[model samples]
Target chain A: MEFRDAWAIASKDLRIELRSRILTNQIAPYTLLILVLFGFALDADTQTLRDTGPGLFWVAVLLIALLAIQRAVKIEDDDAAKERMLLTPVHSSSVFLGKAIALFIQLFVLEILLFFVMLALFDLSVEDPLLICVSAVLATIGVASSGTLYGVIAAGVGVRETLLPILLLPVLAPIAIGATRTFGDAFGRVDADGWAWFGLLSVFAVVYTVLGMLAYGQLMEDA
Target chain B: MNDVIDLQEAVVTLGQFPALTGVTLKVSQGEIVTVCGPNGAGKSTLLRLCAGLLPLREGSAHILGEDLQKNRRIIRQDVGLLGHRSGLYDDLTVEENVAFWGQMVRAESNEINEAIKLLGLDGRLRKVLVRQLSAGQRRRTSLAGLVVQRPLLWLLDEPHAALDSDGRDLVDGLIHEAAASGATIVLASHAPKDISSPSGRFVTLAGGRVTNDINNDGSGDGVS
Candidate 1:
């Protein structure tokens, strides 16, 4: 019930992550690697590549975020941090918030890395800065809530490294599709139904956020 | 004797296997009861159910006169739980490790400081990571966390697995301290211990049911 309870968990995680920079640094190059690979697969077709580039770029970004998120999920168990956190009287909802925030920041950073990489790779232009940023933020939230929940689940029973992605991507596909279409609207210079996908991704983020908060205590209970 | 931890037909089941069947148990405010059994003897299950970590499939449990499901958080606030695993983060220093949990439970800084001293961790508080410490030291941090907050009930599983003679004594002392405060202690271990002078009730189980329920008569609690 403490106002700063969630921040307590969040600050601890952020502090530890800052102390060991390996966790975030690994994502930056991984984003670049995926972009380079995407370029090779697309080849030199300006017309086809540009039309699909926006969609593929976001897909690459989402995948990179997912990768980083999976690692973030395991942070608790890496050093028995999860159990230590559970022992506290802080509500489980706060724990979920702390973890979701950590992953959200990591995902946002990954998306930023993708934005720069896309500009360099294909001379990408930001058609609407506001819309692109909005879509990216929503997409990251959608990924962070769902990814952190599954990460907690996996951390309890299985090897989180393999289980996090498998559990998150399928559940988060709607976010990706929504992000793809929204980003495409910005790049294609049209505003057709972009708000629809925006609405959909927003709903996903809220639903998962609530689900993660309410269920984490139960998760800790059995595990 | 005023009952501190009393179970009334506490039946907890997991899928097809009945974990705790028609089990009746009682421990006074200053009593120490050790539940010993085989691997699948439901020792851990009973402790977990009491800790509100496991659900009661049938019957009910009352901790300090509070229902588990309806008042789980209140009970959790007053209970200290330590499972078979040390559950210590290997990367953080000992001070951070204890502080993190203490901060969550809102333990006073002075209480945490006293726990650190009692556990003999003041010298290596900031320098040693859990991974760098011996098993005994790692367990000691966990003990410190358990003692930092003054809980009315203590539910522990395999607490002395990695502890040395001195470490065991440390735990034994903490158990006595908690009981002197009218806290109920339920410990699950595989071996016998010589820490307390109270009436140590022995509950032995097999196939997830009480096989004998006897007092410290050395004949095993006649729980069968």
Candidate 2:
């Protein structure tokens, strides 16, 4: 309801992510390394890289984004977080917004790194790098919103480690699928109706963002 | 202005479990009331019900003369809360944490700065990450967060549970300030010994029911 509170809470999370850059930055090199390994493991074939590059890019983004999401939720995992944040004066939705912002920033940075890797490894002269950036941004928003929601629910479960990825896959599988379509359409010789996929991604972002803002007030109280 | 929170024999349930039942209480403007009891006494549940964190399965809950179910956004903004946890990010600076809450409540730009100064957090040392600070500092940030909202109602659950003497003093001072500012406070606490003041009224709960109510006359701090 209060717009001021939402921005402030979101900024708080962003500031923390900046200060603890080590936590979010850990994924960048690993993600890059995976892409490089894919290039080397595939016998340096250009056609194969083009065929699988889009899929590889989205998969790397998902896994890297997962690293940041887990760390963001874990920031409130200890007893001190319960004493401090779960009961603080700020709205619970504010907390979720702040963490989601942190997740988005982390994913955006990874996407940039992937751009360079795509050029260097595959020598893929894809037009409109910024278009992929735009698609990545929308896709990142979806990932952050969904991941944070599930992370909160599974924070205390017995099989939290196993439960998180398994539970998230079905909900987020479409992100990888849709994002790959968008990326391929931006540059590849694909003729599938990618605008519909982009539209679906946008709708997902709006719907989930609304659902999170509304339901989060209840979840934070119990957490 | 009338009763900030009015409950008429309200009952709340979680699925098949009973969290609150047949409970009636009134919180008016400019009042501080403590809900004290052992664990599972539903003291926290009572606070949640007043804050509209749970749906009322029986009776009714009204805030500022409006039904809680119909006017939740208004009531939530009017109510400030701090649960057992510190509810802070160790990585965020004290000022950042304060500013975050300030933004949520749409406080004036100076409100965050003033709260930081009021809490004695002006030095560059205060700009460091919360995780790097001491436990006392974290609690200070958490309390400063409430200052940003300055809500009409403050619902705290065991807010003083893990603090040292200084942290306890900080919380005590904040409560006094909120009460002085005409805020209605309903705080739930299991520990009775920490609170030595004899100003506000104290209500004790046992097995999910209010069993005793008495004014603090400096005669006794323990309700039961």
Best by TM-score: 1
Per-candidate DockQ vs. reference: 0.45, 0.40
**DockQ of model 1 vs. true complex:** 0.45
What lDDT score goes with residue B157 in model 2?
82
Model 2 Cα shift for residue B122 (angstroms): 3.9
Per-residue accuracy of model 1 over B50-100 as CA lDDT, tens digit each: 776666777777877788768766676777878766656666778887887
TM-score of each: 0.87, 0.80
Give the Cα error of residue A60 in candidate 2, in Å: 1.6
State residue A34's C-alpha deviation in candidate 2, in Å: 2.3
Interface RMSD over true interface Cα atoms for each candidate: 2.5, 4.5
Model 1 residue runs over 4 Å out of place are A1-3, A16-22, A44-49, A75-88, A150-167, A188-197, A218-223, B210-224
Q: Measure candidate 1: CA RMSD.
A: 3.2
Separately for all candidates shown, the number of backbone clashes (residues 3 or more apart, or on different chains) is 12, 17
